[model samples]
Target: MQDFLLHGILAISAIHMAHCNPDKREKYATISARHQNIALSQFSPGLTEIGENNADAYVLHAICIFLVNTYSIANPQGPITSRDVAQSFILLQGIRSILALPFAHRYIFNGPLARWLYQGSVEPAVGGNYSSKIDDLLNLTRSMAPSDDTLTCQSALEGLKHTFAAVSTPQHRKGLVWRWAVSLPQSFLELMSQNHPMALVILMYYAALVYAFERNMWYLTGWGSNVASALDKAIQEPWREWIQWPLRCIREGVDIRQVEPLKPVEGNPRTQLPTINFNLGLFKPSEPPP
Candidate 1:
């Protein structure tokens, strides 16, 4: 399954590269359909459970995570000295993905795990909750060992922390609180509002983990005297200050008071409504022609 996902993404990337014009490198570089679909679908409330078998969501989720992991492994940004170690870690994650697909949809989809295999089966055309789809994929990924290596562990941890942050249930809050403490302020959070707050939150979560990963890589490359001192410096005020500046500016510019809060609609029993509309131009209603 993991191999299939990797091949699919590579194939798509190759096609995009071949067909795309040289002037369109920037556009093609941003061809992250998998990530976009996951984000857009998840934020929609109407897509909670849309298919007869709910297989579409499962496959989409699986493939996206698989690609993310594959991309991270193939194009590592840090610590290339241990190529063998990194390759083994990637292989480990691949194996875990292949094995976990069976249990991934078992609880929610409630059917044979084999039904969603990558051998030849394709899902139906029903739409799905992108967030929920990725949530399941993240959960499957989380079941794997987190102590694989600094890089692998960092990647896995970041993925799990971000994806689960989407679902705002009581159980998930505990995890969020833990994650929030370590996550530094991020610029992306400024773009998010109540409607899609999870996107901002999740991005920051991974950003924080990556910050830590990069700090460690600094020590590995002998930038600092040793790993301990580098890690200590990473957690110190300098790093925190650097991240805080941009986030603080964004926070100041965005006016929260202007955005009306969600509330129950007046005189409507069935629906929870937004804040009252305050259009000033209309004359007040005069008792409706009694």
Candidate 2:
């Protein structure tokens, strides 16, 4: 557990050094990887022993492991494929595995997670409450005939929306994106890994959400474009149409708010919703959305 925590800090410092201390980048990355391997060695055995004394540590370890793997794939030096992005979703499912233990409820309410769970009011979404883009995209899953797949897709979309709203205030960066992945079920994760058309469509929005607030993040830089391009190429018609806005945003490397909205129907008199202008400077780079 301590190794996991130590490796996490080192991995984070390595990312920090990419911008703050480029000369020290390789040195920290090397040491971080060595410590991470030691942490990995204990992961399997640790899984079986997640009792009261170890539950908190185990959950933290899950988060650290996911971030480390995601960082490796999202590194700008490498190419990011739809398959590579899928690995991030799979790593997130590992967190679900830990939480499914019999003592899950206790872990959330009685452990280190409580403060976060009971955290105060959440920030609103862009365009106030989910934007029309989200409404249009979600219609595909929301209207699906009820089934395991429908339920899973619904759950994943809901999670994506929750993350979309949570990150809209612009102060959010990095790890907040993990919330969407963590909320998914194993079935949805498999769909994403296989690059299913509908699942990829959902992922396009996930990419847009990342771009919306945190495209500047170290581990997430260019993720929006990489994910959008991969999915845009992989998905066929009808479903492909669902991804245009995000694809364009990624292609242009512009913020979502910077993209012009779709024009309203000729006969439609519904006024376009006004967007709130958030003060990005209100919070430091390390703070949550203001």
Candidate 2 residue runs with Cα over 4 Å from true position: 18-27, 100-113, 117-130, 141-151, 169-175, 252-290
What is the alpha-carbon lDDT for the whole of candidate 1?
Answer: 0.31
Model 2: lDDT of residue 102: 57
Instruction: Write the residue-wise lDDT of candidate 2 on 9-85 in tens digits.
Output: 66556555543555665666666666666666655555666677677676676666655555555444444566666
Q: Count backbone clashes in candidate 2.
A: 0
Best by lDDT: 2
Screening candidate 2 with a backbone cut-off below 3 angstroms (N, C-alpha, C), the clashing residue pairs are none
Please give the lDDT score at residue 200 for candidate 1: 27
TM-score of each: 0.23, 0.72
lDDT of 1 by residue, 126-195 (tens): 2233233334434644664663332333343354444334223333322232232222222222222221
